[model samples]
Each structure stands twice: as structure tokens, then as C-alpha cells.
Target: MHKAGIPLPNDQVNADDVKAVQAMSEKLWKMDLAEQRVALAVLISLCDCIVWWTQRHK
Candidate 1:
């Protein structure tokens, strides 16, 4: 018999997250040289902030 308090299994991934990733990839692919450079810079900045916040809590 199944336990009363146990959580059920999730059989499918979220489609919206998948779609966002796909859209980002497509944008990166279609970006011009200048746009690509700016996009990369923004991504690096965001990553740095994330890392800093994570380290601060430790």
C-alpha cells in the first residue's frame, strides 16, 4: 500500500523552462557580432553576482 504522507512522482519536466532555454539559444545564434558581445557581457555579470551572493552566505 502507498504511504499517506509521501509525495507523488513528477513524470514530466516543465515546458516553460524548456521554451525559455530554447529561445535564449536561438537569440544567441541569431545575434550579430556586436549584440553577441553585449549578451556575453551581461551573462558574465549575472553569473558573477550569483557567485558572490552564494559565497557571502557561507
Candidate 2:
């Protein structure tokens, strides 16, 4: 995809990206349902805190 003749770099891949995929594949995505639910709740709370902090700073 391009905007104003500048192409998006969606095809880019780096070592960190590869490692993150491998880690998630070996851990989070392989978790049982109950464990996954707990993980999801934690992620939600973390995101909420992030948003709150950003808004407070702004």
C-alpha cells in the first residue's frame, strides 16, 4: 500500500519480531483456556493503566 507515492514497509521483518513470534508460539498461544483467560485479564488491566497514564500526562 502507498500513500502520496510512499510505499508502506509492511513486508519488513527483524530478528526481534521473529523471536517474539517464537516465544508466543511456545507460550501464550499454547496456553490452556483458563490460563489464557487470566492472561487476557492481565493484558486488559495493563492496557487500561497505559491509557490512563497517557491521558493524565496529556
Candidate 3:
């Protein structure tokens, strides 16, 4: 398989480069509700950071 390209914010959805996410999902599924909330918060924070970083360069 060819190397997957960097996906743009609005690029058409495709099934590639999600192994890490799948792993995270499995781990989260095993966690209790409280732990899941913490994990979700962490993911949201990372998203915020990425958004800030991208806009900072534009």
C-alpha cells in the first residue's frame, strides 16, 4: 500500500492511518466511566492544541 498522505481538515473520509485511534478506543472501552471521561478530555485538549497551532501559522 502507498504511504498515506496527510489528511486535510475537510478531506473526504477514508479508512487509513487509524490504528492508534483504534487502540485508544479499545482501551477506553475497557475503562470505567470516570476514566473514559478523563481520556475524552485529554483527546479534546489535543484537538484544541492542534487547532491553535494550525491557526497560528495561517
CA lDDT, every model vs. true structure: 0.62, 0.62, 0.59
- Candidate 1: worst-modelled 10 consecutive residues by lDDT: 1-10
Q: Which stretches of candidate 1 lie over 4 Å from their true place?
A: 1-27
Candidate 1 structure lDDT: 0.62
Collision count for each candidate, in order:
0, 0, 0
How close to the true structure is residue 38 of candidate 2, measured as C-alpha lDDT? 64
- Candidate 3 residue runs with Cα over 4 Å from true position: 1-27
Using Cα atoms with residue i matched to residue i, what is each candidate's TM-score against the true structure?
Answer: 0.52, 0.55, 0.52
Q: What would the per-residue lDDT of candidate 3 be over residues 1-58, giving only the tens digit for each residue? A: 0122322122333467587557655654766676556656766999999999999999
Work out candidate 1's RMSD over C-alphas.
15.4
Provide C-alpha RMSD values for all models, in order.
15.4, 15.2, 11.3
* lDDT value, candidate 2, whole model: 0.62
- Candidate 3 yields a Cα-based lDDT of 0.59
What is the TM-score of candidate 2? 0.55
